[model samples]
Target chain A: MDKKIKMRAEGVNFFYGRTQALKNVDILIHANQVTALIGPSGCGKSTFIRLFNRMNELVPDTSLSGNIYLDDLEINSAQIDPVEIRKRVGMVFQKPNPFPKSIFDNISYGLRVNGVRDANSIEERVEASLKKAAIWDEVKNRLNDSALKLSGGQQQRLCIARCLAVDTEVILFDEPCASLDPISTAKIEELILELKKDYTIVIVTHNMQQAARVSDYTGFFLLGELIEFGKTQDIFTAPQDKRTEAYITGRFG
Target chain B: MFTTLFFLGLIIFFVGVRGAKVISWEFLTQIPRCSMTQGGVAPAIVGTLYITLGAILFSLPLGVACAVYLCEYSPKGFMVNIIRISINNLAGVPSVVFGLFGLAVFVKFFGFGVSILSGSLTLGILALPLIISSTQEALLAVPQSIREASLSLGATKWETIKRIVLPAALPGILTGVILSIGRVAGETAPILFTAAAFYMRGYPKSVFSEVMALPYHIYALMTEGVHPDRQMAIAYGCSFILLFLVLSISGIAIIIRQKQRIQHG
Candidate 1:
């Protein structure tokens, strides 16, 4: 099988009502590599990541005038259902949002919604996904307990496990550890490194060190523009743009 | 002044303590007849049960659906604006006006004259706006992220609504249902206009059977009846029962809301 570019966003200009959030941004993401989007808050990195799966489409008064491609198919057209694209492209939010249900049910929710009704299959897949998320050991004994009873970090991992259970092809994580503690953040970074071996991962983070640690390629976003895009090492160590250089040096975010 | 305040407090406390202590298993399980002095509140109790049940069944689905549209699917425009205004007005409409409306519509047009159906429909309409507003509040309280998360999980908008949004809002929706039930139970104006018969000696035989609700009976007992002792007894008994039912339902709704708040917090 030939490997393909998993996602591509070209000349994507997005706006919230009259205010433009992204300005003619373009990028190509390949399969099985972690692409880290680093930018200051409100810099459109989150907006850019959301556009890949059309999750940005949900915001009221939000508009997009660009094309995003997934597996050679244009995702911006009516022929492509946003819901279907979202299935193939999963999203984990900044806040840990486990359903107010049991651990097993939280992980199995996506599968159940997709019409998987087999009890044994759902149970097996939930365990496997939780194991992959590295939360199986922590929550195995408490599968029947309410997911809300878990600690914050455990809840975030449960969210990751839930995404995996849906069998998503590409995972979009928008600041998955921003609300978590440093220990939880480190754990998620480690999981992202492990996750990239099997799934294509795109992440948005404000932390330069996180991008340096986990990403294969890093895209630096500044003032709604893609200022730099290259191998993570190059962007952090030998960036070719002054704006990118200035951003990485901590002078300005 | 201090003695007066203390004596007043003591009287109120005694009444509450006596009411609580006096309530036995029979208070719930027994069927009231002529009076406890003459009989208990059997007929009014039965009428309350049927009317409240009928109102809930009639209003819950319609109320929740309306709320879902207002909160989730509505475009911000003139029509939604009009609907919001009308619903608010309907909630504020005098219970007497609701009673007259019920008498004109359900009693006359539907031809279910002086019957349970008429009363239930009137109560349902009266309660609809409340449930719709409460449900809208509940739906609004659900984080938009949860809906987005579900939709992005390959679920269609309806699927997301049915699965995540509704489930998350279930306890909240039940809060609305409970509140509506509490309101309907205490409603006497609509019932009087639509279904209050002069005298009902037997249990209602069918949906169209004209029945005597507790409020109407209390009204009749107070206004015209010769048995002052028995009538006053009935009034105390019915008021105690009605007050208890209303408090319980409202308390349950508050608890459900509190639980949801705790989870979200």
Candidate 2:
């Protein structure tokens, strides 16, 4: 079977007020595949992923020279609205940020904001999204409770459900499990494995075990450049680059 | 703080005792008679209510909008810095200076005359700086994470502000409003030149008509009213009423801010 490309970046260079963060880099993301970017801190993995949704523009004095394609559409063009790009590409931050509202409202916020005004459809979608995030059974009894009252892992799952509620074609997770416990991290990893069958998933993780366990395609970034990227199995077992071998073998980050 | 509260307690006790004899249901509802020596200050109370409400109505939207622009939209530049400095300076300017400016602009130049319209406009200007600063603080108090989450969910900037930032900042905004109310209610200088009537019959029929207010009424009672003893007693009553109004507003604002802190904690 021929794998189709869902997103692509070409010669992307990013600068934050004259200091370059991402050097010239190129990568292709496949449809319905979990692509994990693994690197040390400040490797520009998160910055590169943010470019797909135009989130880097939120920072003042930041500039990008690149061509990022979301299924053949140049999302970086001035004519393309960032808001519309964000609708198609959703993101979950390192920290779970649930709104200070009820659980039901938190899940339905994205739907409501996207003009889903019908009550029955909103209710159905909220339930469906909660189930998709694998948090429905835990929270079904207390839909009206404040989301802040939930545990850390539950809140992260709720954030996932929120992203799913928007019907995004691509989901970006920036260190989603960085704050979770072992059990919660396992649960989130399982959810990510299941989710990639329907939506393209791109996650940035410091945990190599998480990348190896959940991702199909893995990209190893070293100091703002893509050093190696291929099938997760091939990169983990037979890394083509010495740096990828050294970093994956616990020699250095 | 203890020392100030002790002085405040003493003053309140003294005024409360002196004014107790004059204050009543009739004193509040009946119109002042015989140069305010016999009848109740109904018109003054009504006038103060109208003017304060008008000032809030005029300033709240303008103040909140200015705060939103300053906090959310304005780029950090020399122009924004200058605007912020001017706002702080405006807050420091004397109420008497604001009064003079209001008299020149709203009363004489704008042809509003010595009416509620002029007084409310003047009072609104006096309250603007305080309202803006407090509202900016309120908007700033909302966590940036909420804004990022909203925007990441594809909400427009205005939508994020309206749905997430504004809701989270509402209690703080209300606290600012309560404080502004206290300032507007107790202020005498601005209204004296722009809107205070020496005397008026019945309630003000329109914004163009002059109206009596509590602060200026107290001033008149002490300085120019007919009988010294009776006027002094009415002045105490008026002072007590004004003190009560300001204190209650402040009390409510403090309670709201405390509740908000505890909730966030």
Candidate 1 global TM-score:
0.93
* lDDT score for residue A129 of model 1: 98
- Residue B54, model 2, lDDT: 91
Task: Give the per-residue Cα lDDT of candidate 2 at B264.
Answer: 67
Task: Please give, for residues A36-108, the per-residue lDDT of candidate 2 as tens digits.
Answer: 9999888999988889888888899999998999999999888999999889999988988998889999978
lDDT per residue for candidate 1 within B142-225, as digits (tens), equals 888778777877888888777778888898889888988988988888898798774666678988998877767667766776
Which number leads on TM-score? Answer: 2
What candidate 2 gets wrong by more than 4 Å, as runs, is none
Q: Chain B TM-score for each model? A: 0.87, 0.98
In the predicted model 1, the residue pairs found to clash are: B32-B42, B34-B39, B35-B38, B35-B39, B35-B40, B36-B39, B36-B40
Report the lDDT tens digits of candidate 2 across residue range B116-197: 9999999998888889998999999888877888888999999999888988898889998899999998888999999998
